[model samples]
Target: MLIALISLFLAGSSGGSAAGSLTAAGVLALVVVFSAAATLAVSFLLSKTLLRGESSAFTLELPPYRVPRIGQVIVRSVLDRTLHVLGRAAAVAAPWGLAVYALANISAGGETLLSWFCSWLDPAARLIGLDGVILAAFVLGLPANELVIPIMLMAYTAGGCLTEISSYAALSEVLSGNGWTAMTAVSVVLFTLMHSPCSTTLLTIKKETGSIGWTAAAAVIPTAAGIGLLAVLNCIFG
Candidate 1:
């Protein structure tokens, strides 16, 4: 979703499809790698500090190696793991998508609540090297990471649905018209890496910890890091 949204905007911008799509894909790759590393580091620190516990040791013995059963492996992989993950993802995504769609179309006092909310957040977002629409996308997309780009496109284009821009050139034009720059893309990639996990992940965390406080910490810690990191970068580079 992030790559699609960014690529669309870049394609619409000055360089055309080739440059814009390539840059967007490169940024997306960076974001994925950085996010994984950051998440691991944060998890380690949290485990040592806030989630600390007395250490325990266990010994393992290797079993005699044998060829695994192919049918059993397929069943376990597909039925036990893949289906479970898909179910959780679907549960989280559907409602949030509906809510975002409504927010885009629903209006109060001649303006959408989505636009009003974005405007309210614009200043703080700019401070962190992002704009209101990007921040709003993050917030509204909490339920699923995949929703972020759709939310951004809807917000930027003021479309009733999670509308597609059809071509990269059109996407670039929309993004340029909305004041996107390379810095904006960089900030977005960084923020996406450091921001809180999706709602499903949070739910899983809460389930494992069985504590709202820890779950809240899980959300806040990464967000704080992202904000601080981006603010520093923007100050130095902007």
Candidate 2:
């Protein structure tokens, strides 16, 4: 699970335009170090607490090595893995896409639903060094992390649909125009590393655990840690 979260963070950070800058690379390295340390610390704590159990060791029987079948392997890879993941992502993203469109289009008393929702979340978001739009983006992006920046851009521009920036320069301009700063970027990176898993991941966890309690824990633990850490950072630096 920690590996999955770190992978997501790496993907997000590396995809940004700022990633090309030396300063951004340094920040990424720092975050990577922090992630590694946190993973080890969390694992140790879990072993001593929630995961305490009698030690047991078991050996697995090795499967006999077999020659690879290229055609069969390709077929299984496409049909089983690629299609399965895409299907699940589409199932979640389709509805979310519609909802986002509506939220951006519909308005009451001169405020779009998206704006109103962001306003409502603004106070809490500010505590974590993020704006309401960014928070709303993260919440709406629960379906897929890839939607986050697009959703944020749409909200910022009051666009009726997701807005895609074609270049990193444009993306950086939009973010800065919306008041993003170095601290904001740091906060965002931290939250990206620590926030809850995407919807598909949560569903998979629920299915694998067969327990709502564990599934909720999987979502909540990292989020709570993120909130706590950000709160402290804001207090110290705000």
Q: Could you estimate the TM-score for every candidate? A: 0.77, 0.84
CA lDDT for candidate 1: 0.81
> Which residue pairs in candidate 2 collide?
none
Q: State the weakest 10-residue window (summed lDDT) of model 2.
A: 1-10
Q: Write the per-residue lDDT of candidate 1 for residues 1-238, one digit (tens) a residue.
A: 4665556543345344567667767766777787788878877887798769946466899999989999999999999888877788778788877888788889999999899989999999989889999999999989877777778888888888876666655766777788988678768877877889998788788878899988998899999989999999999987
Q: How well does candidate 1 match the true structure in TM-score terms?
A: 0.77
Tens-place lDDT per residue, model 2, 1-238, is 1222222333354543454344445546788999888778866776788779945467899999999899999999999988987887788889988898889999999999999999999999999999999899999999987788788899998888889977555766777788877678778878888889998888789878899998998888888888889999999997
Best by TM-score: 2
**Candidate 2 lDDT score relative to the true structure:** 0.80
> What's model 2's lDDT at 104?
94
lDDT of each: 0.81, 0.80
Per-model RMSD to reference: 4.0, 5.1
- Model 1, 92: alpha-carbon shift in Å? 2.2
